[model samples]
Target: MDRTLLEGLFRHAVAQAQPALAIERHLPAPPKGRTVVIGAGKASAQMAQAFEKAWPGEISGLVVTRYGYRAECERIDIVEAAHPVPDAAGEVAAQRLLELVSGLSEDDLVVALISGGGSSLLPAPAQGLTLADEQAINRALLASGAPIGVMNLIRNQFSTIKGGRLAAAAAPARVATLVVSDVPGDDPALVASGPTLPLRGGRAEARRLAALYRLDLPEAAQRLLASEDNLPPEETDAVFANNSVATIASAALSLEAAAEMARGAGLEAAILSDSIEGEARDVAQVHAALAREIATRNRPFPKPVVLLSGGETTVTLRGTGRGGRNGEFLLSLAIALDGVDGVSALAGDTDGIDGSEDNAGAFVDGTTARRMREAGIDPQAALANNDAYGAFEAIGELFKTGPTGTNVNDFRAIVIR
Candidate 1:
């Protein structure tokens, strides 16, 4: 398989994972009373648009998504906000979303469109805790390379509308959550930090995670977590019992679609796993080794094979680098491959944003090293500084698909021919 063909196949898979189409298939019927839609995520806008198209009744309300990810809907309002960190815009949007569902009756319908990036995009800080406090802690969490679950656990405790609080606010309304799974295991509670389900962990766990990661959290956040009043949602048929959550799409399904495309192109395709998680660079090194062994000996599946995997990867910030997990993975893989022949790979986040960087991820071919050298970029220095974006930009090969309007996690494909 050539580099062009591999890129085409990867792009095809990404299109199939878009939220608008996926959300359409999972939408339920319109509620008996007013149908109010409220959600947060990178794909929230697209999800709302799909719901509006599918529903038969009057739909109104708002949802928040990452900047540049907004979609058009005549009845539903779309709000854009910052991601990976909470912003004032997100705080106001979150409060409005919660307010929309405040007086919903048992007959009312509250559709929560959940997806990746929602945790940061929807910020309703609890009483006595300012958005600045939440933002500070959020910044610390992102820099610490803590797992998404751990980070969200802390955020949920300090928020007025996360970890089942959204449902709690909706009182007697019948709530249904339509989520695009991005985290490993596709845990509904972890998806969008479980705005409708009962939260399990508490401040003790948050403090333990902070200690384990050595993160410097805000004093207000620390005290809030330590407070006895900080507790998870309680079980009740009215709120917890009536709320229904369903995963509309996930990384595993997306990987399967990609595998099918590869097979159609006459390449033997294998999906390694969908729940992969770890440091981005470390995972890339391991994947590179596997590809090398397979290419050299054909032990796994022989030549003309495409090894595919999907899942979110984390990066522990050790330098002032500007790249997402996909970029970091490609940098590490390039080093591991070390000019090896007959291997071409692409790693990228499905959401079209890698970390806070502009590009989703980078691609590497057999001659990627030579291309970097030709471009006069120091590949080793770039990797050390976490400057995958710079290195790939110099080579004119950075993957630039802006605002895919979806979030499943990372997509990686290694082709050996």
Candidate 2:
């Protein structure tokens, strides 16, 4: 019953952060010239679909999303591509999005439906760089376990369209971006690397981030980072004179709904934070300590309460893991709890996909570790191999929700009863 209710809370959170409910309320008025919708993200397709239904005038555009994550849109063209890594399809989509917005008049309105996963979905490499080079840098960053913000900063230096370049291409036209933030701070400029919203920092800042993360960037990317030409447009640039941004959805939005739902269930709920960021295992350890405190002493808020949080946790790949950050987090939590009674938890990406794995995430309880041992699964060994997916699957506990068609990043809940 705890697991069922937890899943319900997760679904409710996703529903509250959806673009269908968000886009209409924030839609820009119809432009006198034209309304061209262009977007790139895991949720961009759905945002476009929503925009189409909400707009009062004729709208035409295209949006790119990860393969198998596409949504239906009658007037908007939906393109499928790779994610977490760039591909030829993504490169083409990047070029096309720029072209579609180029040469627009001031009377025209460019509505950008932006969301997470746009970084790789629209990879327009720098002047001398190639898509493969961009892919190489992305792989290194993902493996390095750098926070999403730093990774995006480095990516902006090597991309032609990122860091507000997308909005710049549609210069003189009024650009209104509807964003679904997946970053810790809900900065629209960092979502999907801010294709439409320009970042404020310069090349110097990008270099500092690259060195701070010790990012093993490709040769071309390295050169671009060294060159002054890699700098993104300043906040005062004329192209941004009439541009606007709306953070229609985020982790905070979902977390609020989940908290309300928990209260409705007759459980006291505490939202730790909507912007939690750290290594997955480390984060789990901290959360476990809190849960332990509440269970053993009833210190924090007492028993029969739910602790909720939402953020995209990074997983440092030390081994070949079969799971994403959420899996890693749950595996580590299970280890730390080690059969502490009266506690159960669920952690998963709200996008319905956790990292590169099919399962959104998994469930862990006080009995989870014991169950793993009974199934002949070494929880510690599985974690060491980064195989949380395998461990959960063997015990029939992998939480699979498929693609939810919307993304507000990660969702977690701990029910202490």
Candidate 3:
């Protein structure tokens, strides 16, 4: 249970979750006619490349991904856009994608590659709403501390392409969606707002979410919500519907792979939960307690145990700090596990980029507190500023993976001996 072994386990888990291998193996047969590939998400570009390799016939279309995640695709055009926030490029991509599917006949196939960040990558604002308005709304939502489910629910209400609307636009054509699910439950409707599915909920949920989050709706959005057209279901066919929605990869799957790897390395492994949610700092405290239990009392588990969990956590934006959710979670954990022995942990988003920062996440060994103490950095103060990335960077503890070209939410592993 040395530092190198613990770190290797974390890296192994991340490698198992990369989209190239995991996502490429889940392809369905290319349609008899033209196969029109369309997608949006952090991994859509990588997913598109996989589609080209697996398809038997001709394929052409577009898939938008977060900046720096684009892969080379001959027939399928790959577009890069902003994530966690919508941009004009995404707006254009959404319009073009809608156009691409609109002309497909029943004989054609619309292979929709979807994953996390699709909501922001494929943002085509509803009529009367501008990209700026959408951006403002998105900024507000991210800052509101709402869970992904609630945030996507609200997003679906404001977009013309989300919440199954994309599937509707490709009516008559057979549509199959291949997804790398980043959501807790892997619900088709919740992953990137289920672009290839139909909206099933009413506007009431969106209305309640806005009010609950104290979000100020623009006039255009408010007007649309009041209208009857809000979240109206679009017509779609059932051809190849049985296996149309397939989750090629998920956070739980990645975590299990990590746990197995850890066990093989002579460490007892425990997977806490893959659907953990709520505040990042709060979740870290709970994880810290579990680490301590394994290190000392061994009440729930014995020594030489590695605790693993996967799920998206939220930061309420209390301070103007720079970091993603994973970094924040590690900072909080480091504080809680301060001066504790034989406990080390790594928490990071499966996607290389975390939140608005470029770092994947941060890692903390048993000496994290000691290192911070020597540097005169207050873990508590850093946590308060939501500056986990800053603190970790100052101490060279930030984990940087650039872009793994996938998104399956967060991966957290703690090894205690």
Candidate 4:
């Protein structure tokens, strides 16, 4: 298998999902009156820049993005904040965004650029809850191995600006949200905890998820969830009447671009699914088995074929690993393959960061396991300790692409020959 070709396919997939390219056509026209843009996400700053370039009239607003993911924009003020966890900077940004669009008329328009990571980038705790309280719950949720959908549900319950509350705040104005979907199935309500989309379930579901995950919520958070004082408003409320959402970019588009690249390289490509979900290591094991079958018996597809898939995966974190889900997936795949010939794979987050790690993901070939063993590193032991990053770093197989300025979710490709 050509490792260079496999890496090229992954790069092409990420390029296809770039916010600058995907957000242009979906931009709404300038409103008749004032146009105020407010958003929160890793891609939001880039999305704001793209909107400014495509927009004709003068527009002004503020958006919060993960620290180090900011894009240069003249009109829109880009604020950097913590991601995967909320901090004081995010709380301030969320408050300022709410104030920016507080009392707009029907002639005004609110273009909210929401994408992945917004839930953490724009943290506005509910009336009774504090930022530290929200932070505690968020930290627990990240370690709980719950899917993005359920995590966002819990987030919305404790946020003042999430679950359509941002749009509701700008009640009389028309709210047009341009979303870069990072969740499975491209559910707008799940992206960035759906600041402009309505809540799915009420506080009861939030409580159920917390109990199911055994999250030890803070006193204030527990009180907020238990009481009806700060629950999200009904979805059918009049505030949502003029709110609309458009998914400009998603994982499916990136997967298709990858398939086209594979075909161009004289290899057959199959996109298994763009909405795959589950534990990272378990998913990698399944892909490894499929690759083995194709390389040996050819049941699924012939040799010289690339299998591609997208979607986010979770890690339960039972150990003190220093890697994200992508690295964990590649490490597990290497172990399952066990030096089988003619198989190579790459797994990464399109946003150029995996979990809390600095690398986008990692790469592995058939000899990955053998190389680790030769270096006196036990692959199984590493996997057991959730130290995929350490294993990959020792073998010099980490893939680092700093801040791709967009996010659809995880990207995985297995090349069998």
Candidate 3 structure quality by residue, lDDT tens digits, 157-202: 8888888878878877888888888998777678888888764566
Clashing pairs in 1: none
Best by lDDT: 2
Candidate 2 local lDDT, 162-246, one digit each (tens)? 9999898898899999999888879899999998888767789889988988888888888888888757787888999888999
Error of 3 at 341 (Å): 0.5
**CA lDDT of 193 in candidate 4?**
93
lDDT of 4 by residue, 316-361 (tens): 8889979999998999999999869989989999999988888999
Candidate 4 collision pairs: none
What TM-score does model 3 achieve against the real structure? 0.95
The candidate 2 region of ten consecutive residues with least summed lDDT is 227-236
Instruction: Mark the 10 consecutive residues where model 3 has the least summed lDDT.
Output: 234-243
Give lDDT tens digits, candidate 1, residues 1-417.
266766776677677767767776777667779888888899888888888888877888899999889899999899999888889999999888878888778888888888999889988887778989988878888877777788788778888888898888897988888888899888878987888777667678877877898878778777776786656676443567767888988888888888888888899998899988888889988899889988899867888899999877787887786888899899888878867888989888888888888887878876786778789977888887888888898888788788788888888999998
Local distance difference test, candidate 2? 0.91
| Steric clash pairs (candidate 2) | none
TM-score of each: 0.96, 0.98, 0.95, 0.98
**Candidate with the larger lDDT of 1 and 2:** 2
Candidate 4 positional error at 164, Å: 0.6
